[model samples]
Target: MFKEVLQQLGVKQNQSSAYHPQSQGALERFHQTLKSLLRAYCVELKGDWEEGLPWLMLAAREVVQDSLGFSPNQLVFGHKVRGPLALLHDGLKEVSDPPQGLLQYVEGFRRRLFLAGQMAKENLLNKQKKMKRLFDRNTESRVFCPGDQVLALLPLPTSPFCAKFLGPYTVVRQVSEQNYLISTPERKRHSQLCHVNLLKPFYSRFSESEKAPAAVAIASSVTEMAEDVKVPEDGILQPRLNNSETLKKLDEFVKHLPFKQRDELSSLISDFPMLFSDSPSRTNVIEHDIDVGDAKPIRQHFYRVSLEKQRHLESEIKYMIENNIAKPSFSSWASPCLLVGKPDGTYRFCTDYRKLNNITKPDSFPLPRMEDCVDAVGSALYVSKFDLLKGYWQVPLTTRAQEIASFITPSGLYSYSVMSFG
Candidate 1:
């Protein structure tokens, strides 16, 4: 029945030797782990195992497997499954607004899935290397050149008094590393190719006396290999500092900086490594409160854009929508968008909020003067500074403020979730 099913699917069946389950070691190990997990999850009765199986499977898929270095769901679906704990941690709310159209939603998911597949493939390769390193720690390379006489350990059962070693077989050729074709004394090819682990050097003079001991040594070596693989001395491999790719990249980047700047950066970073990050910091919430002070809402006329500017503005709107910086709005207030050209030949998306600012009263609290600020900083023993990528946009606006800050565009009316400069 299985063969018929495979034939229907056009898959060739290659069964491993049942006598040596180690041939399918990976699957066997997985089965063993699954049984252990099932046992832990099903603390009740063996008959109640079916009730907890689904939950156990979900937990298993969500966890990072040792061999793959990723959760099964992540590898298959290209994203981590959000559990109840994850939702709770994220405040039981969506991080960003969903795409406006069905087509856009599908495209976004597809793009993320493709990226996830690439990431999972890289992680799998790294994990395979790590596993191989531990497995090959005490393993020595063995090559059987043609014409080398070796004894093959057969799978046949024998009595306590009978000889276990098969024969002084001559190695015909090395089929591959760890596998060799063998022939009997009569130069007839053996039915099965012998693995290196079950083959030993055959001495003609001491053939009878040494055969048992040679077989014993081969068996012990195979057993040791299995033991070492199953239980590595080090549970987790530690990365070497000298072989760090990140440090190498950092060194290359530092070489491009000015001499004094590099020295100052090195000293500062060496003292405060956590201050450095590959990505910019995120602003999760608003840091200040703004009072419109009973200022009436202002609605500005729609700004005109050329055919080229329309496409650029549309692209910028898409970016803002995707990043959750802005969303589609239908509010009483509206401002016109102004495309300001930069010195670098790029356009900055801005809003004409001059009319709105004129009506809104300014905060009475004043900031410290330049001299006073300089004197206050001079008293400090150590000082460090960093710039926010988009300072104004980092400050989130209130829901009411967002409606009041609505802007008109060719695409539609939109409101900023964060504060924007005029």
Candidate 2:
């Protein structure tokens, strides 16, 4: 049945691969040209696609090809094909002989094809120009220099930097023309050289008002503005509050706490001193005359907690001891520390060497690429996942490197016992 169909279509017998539809480039090109002509003619006629198909077929049959030097219809039918009007205009047909008429028709078709090709080229060029303009308008070219303080934008949910924009990092070095090394107070060691585009300037003014209490002058300024403005029925004419004055009031409020409470709060404020403003009217004195009738005074005791984050240090030491992962000596000065909680509901220690990791040279290890994995897995496979608990702590830290393993905590400084992992 297939043979009969091929014979009816006048297809020649050829190698199976050569005749395969996928391998028939010429046939594919012909189909594409036919589709383009059908679409164009349909658009020109503003008619239904099905109604335009016959006319497109006729046009294609009459079209001349430079390579073949003849229309496909002429080659297939052994005669030139005519359009609808050719049969009705007998006089028009009589003026030219068969060969001469064919030549004129081919010439006319060739001219139209040339014009269409030119129009197509122009359309393509216009599209490319529009695309280039759009691209140029959207492309960002902002750049920064070394030593400039920048805020690094971090991905959620574990960013160590400000919960908002991560950094106020100083660009310490230029790792590449486009990448820079940045450091922050929280990050004791240098961070990985990051792309310049990832950073923006830290606008200190944005947070300045939040730090300190608004001044009396700010309050007076708002009051003055309020006094001058008339309140509108729609509340559209409401006066803006002076933020500086609000900050001053907040400062005054903080200064009235008792001495012990003030001391504790003061310690908290010390780290962010800019958050408070001085107020002459406020005092830190505690009133001792408060009645304690029939009530026994409770005694309070203070004990020093180790500021050194020992829990993290111990985890690192355990990892080093177990895995024997080779690492540099833990430097007391360089080791990064983190606070952890003890089993007894107290604080313990940990250290993060992420900054140090950034500086450490990366090993040239080969890993499987996604494409290779996809190919190897083919189209049918099930996958399972597992995780190692306390994976890093399972390894122990070297004894000589213990000093570098030291970390800072609220209580005191301490060293780690295990190899640490970021």
Candidate 3:
């Protein structure tokens, strides 16, 4: 099939066999001889092997060949090779004898070839040096200051080589001006203080307001009870608004609220806002009371509903909570149950033993003997298949292990109430 495909792609039978060593001995032998000459030339010149490739090719072309009865150059150009002095003498003779323009043309061709070879050598050396520098400087280090945030580059857990920069950590401690201790809440271990060159400052929405001022001025001071401006702490800076200014802002926030709610909000601000003298107040609270005149709250007796209907509702709620199928919050007391509907449109409930089964501990579990399994499968033709439907949901999780088993989805962090494993 592969041969047919290659033939269809325009690969001739002889060309296809060219890759085999036995079929291309002559070409392979030539390549070996060319490589040997290149190595010898590079060693003598104290240069890279790659630097001698073109020169080796030129030398090979000009060298006499036993098979061809002349140099490869002569075979191609239909002429005999000559030294520089011989060519020069020939050119003078040509000027006198006036034999076509061949001698002058050969001199111009030699000059062009020499110039091109020189340029190629310089370009190759420059490119090699650039590539070597890149490989030499593989790892980079960075630093950060106290309170500064930085992203930490880390490897992916599944494929460490395929890892990438994974974090935006906060620099909680500055060990030195050039090194800082970064903090990442999601990471299991704390990262070491890194050098300044590798650390880049994290730009956040609040960074602009956090910049230090050029000069200490009263305009940037915080206001106290007597309208007296206080200088900010050494590393700490105040926002544009002062305490009295913030109080006025708070008053403005509650202005649209009901009179009673506004008074309550003002009282809470007067107490809490006084403690944080430098902190800016950006939050507001509003409340409204609804009037339900002549309306009474509904009350139901448990005995009023049919036993089957009550069971049905409980089962539905249990299923909703177990599978995280509903957005409604479930109480901790909710239990797992099964629902059964009757022909009369009523439903019954059956309590599930899954909750109790979860609490029971496993006494003994066997470990996988991977080596033995591999040995048994050796030299055998076998098909491998995988099942992914309810892949994680099918596994049973212990009650004590459920907390760690909880995972975050688009909806929220949820612990499976039923057996689930991966």
Per lDDT, the best of the predicted structures is 1
Model 3 lDDT tens row, 7-54: 899877644221125346557778888978987887799898887677
Q: Please name the candidate that would achieve the greatest TM-score relative to the true structure.
A: 1
For candidate 1, give the lDDT: 0.73
lDDT on C-alpha atoms for all candidate structures: 0.73, 0.54, 0.53
Candidate 3 yields a Cα-based lDDT of: 0.53
lDDT of 1 by residue, 1-422 (tens): 98899999999976553234667777888788778877876665555677777766776677777655667787777666775434554675658545478887678768877876777788778977887899899888777789887887764443534435677878888876667778864433344576787788886876666666644332221323453243224444334222234545565567768999987876776786543433223477544444577877788788988999999999989978877788999898999997998765678899998888787768888887999978889989998886655567767878778888899998889998888767
**Mind giving the per-residue lDDT tens digits that candidate 2 earns over 73-136?**
6555445567643444555667766455878877877775665556545665776578669877
Question: Better model by lDDT, 1 or 2?
Answer: 1
CA displacement after TM-score superposition, residue 107 of candidate 3 (Å): 21
Model 2 TM-score on a 0 to 1 scale:
0.23
Each prediction's Cα RMSD?
34.8, 28.5, 29.1
- Model 2: lDDT equals 0.54
